[model samples]
Target: MLLVTGITGHSGRYFLQELIKNKYEGPIRCTVRETSNTFLLDNSGLKIEKVFGDLNDQDFIDRVMDGVEVVIHIYNIHHSPNIVQTAIEKKVKRVILVHTTGIYSQFKYASKGYKLIEERISQFKNDTKCPTSITILRPSMIYGDLCDSNMSKFIKMVDKLRIMPVISRGNSLIQPVNARDLGKAFFTVLMSPEKTVGNAYDLTGEMPIKLIDVFKLISKELNKKTFFISVPLSLGVLMARVLKILTLGKINYIEKVQRMAENRNYSHDNATYDFNYEPMSFEKGIIIEVQEYLKKKEGSKSK
Candidate 1:
């Protein structure tokens, strides 16, 4: 039996689709919150046993971990150490941890959080040293349809506003992978544990492109050109901090702006060489995502 976490989440949704589309003939189980939306799973007609509970409950998690063959952990990296320890105790075979490429950011707070989790995951992997193999994947900004926090917001902002807020020259390069491709990469790596186990790989898009070009592409796809007003990097940071103070951290102001300032470009040769991971280009990926966004927009209007 293969168990997955966050099956209703962004990458998890894609991962489940790929699994069903490919006709995976294994007993699949997933951990879902009691309130998680299951429309994708429900509409697909795939039989998945769901363990409804929170990740904080170790006993409940242990119950779900029982008799599982491979575990695909798609959400909540903070709980990784606990999950890995539980998996070790439960004697599970293999575990795949889906992390973010934003961990590589020079921004202090975000870097610290991701680094701490990565360190703990490494510690657990070293401690296991046996039947359990933990593979870590750091994927770049994942965007598809309206489910993403990055490009989807950008698409909507561009669609609604005449002027787009851009920081600095928007020359910083960003390599964002498609949620579908990231999902496929997750599946591909999970299938080949021997080669991917105990290894950390960065899964990114086909190529890195300028942030300005990304906006331009979004404009092109939406068929609406917009003016770009460049704001100083320092000013942008100040605004984010101010908003955080105002909202009491409800905004996550730092990550939204600081990440855009740093170059998030990465090499996928490691992921590809390891598990034949091939991600689509941002151009095509964004197009598909935009179409989905349009569908959702139309859906809301109809309702």
Candidate 2:
């Protein structure tokens, strides 16, 4: 049986779609919270065993880990150390973990926890007694869906405002992987364990594009022209700090603006060579995202 986590999440839903499309014959099970909506899973028509409990609970983890040969872990990376430790303890044959590229960030504060989690995974990999094979996938900013946090906000901002404020002239290059591409990459890695196991791959977009160009692409797809207002890095950081304070620490973008000043481009050559991973270009992906955003926008108006 194959065990999956985060099966109801944004990218996880896409991965589930791939499993359904391919008609995966293996017995599958997923861990979901009691409050997690099962709309997709209920309607997916897949006979998946649903186990409800908190992953943080040791008893719950043990219950879900029962009789599982392969595990697809798409939940929060912060929970990985515990999950991997349990997987190792249970002697699961193979485990695929979905991590993020944020661990490579220059900012220590932002990447510290991710780095620590990966360090433990690396140690587990070196342990000779551990029988599980671990493969880690780090994806860049994930977009391509209305539920995504990155590009969807940009599309909405550009659609609503003619004048868009850009940080650092929006010059830094970013390669955002589409959620579908990332999800498919998970499926690809799962099927080819020999090539993917014990290997860490960076899955990114077809090419990196300037941040301003991303905005321009969204504007083009929306059939609108936007005026860019460049905010200096220093001033942007200051404003983020002020906003955080004003929001009583509810809204924080200090690190976000700081990271925006640096380039976030990485090579996916390794993933491509390993699993034939091919991601769509940002332009093409943005066109679809913009259309989805418009449809959702119209949907709200109709309601």
**In lDDT terms, which candidate is top?**
2
What are the lDDT figures for the candidates, one per model?
0.86, 0.90
What TM-score do all the candidates reach, one by one?
Answer: 0.92, 0.96
What residue pairs are clashing in model 1? Answer: none
In candidate 2, what are the lDDT values of residues 60-83, reduced to their tens digit? 888889888999899999888888
Residues 108-164 of candidate 1 have per-residue lDDT tens digits of: 877888998888877777773556888888988888778888899889888998888
lDDT of 1: 0.86
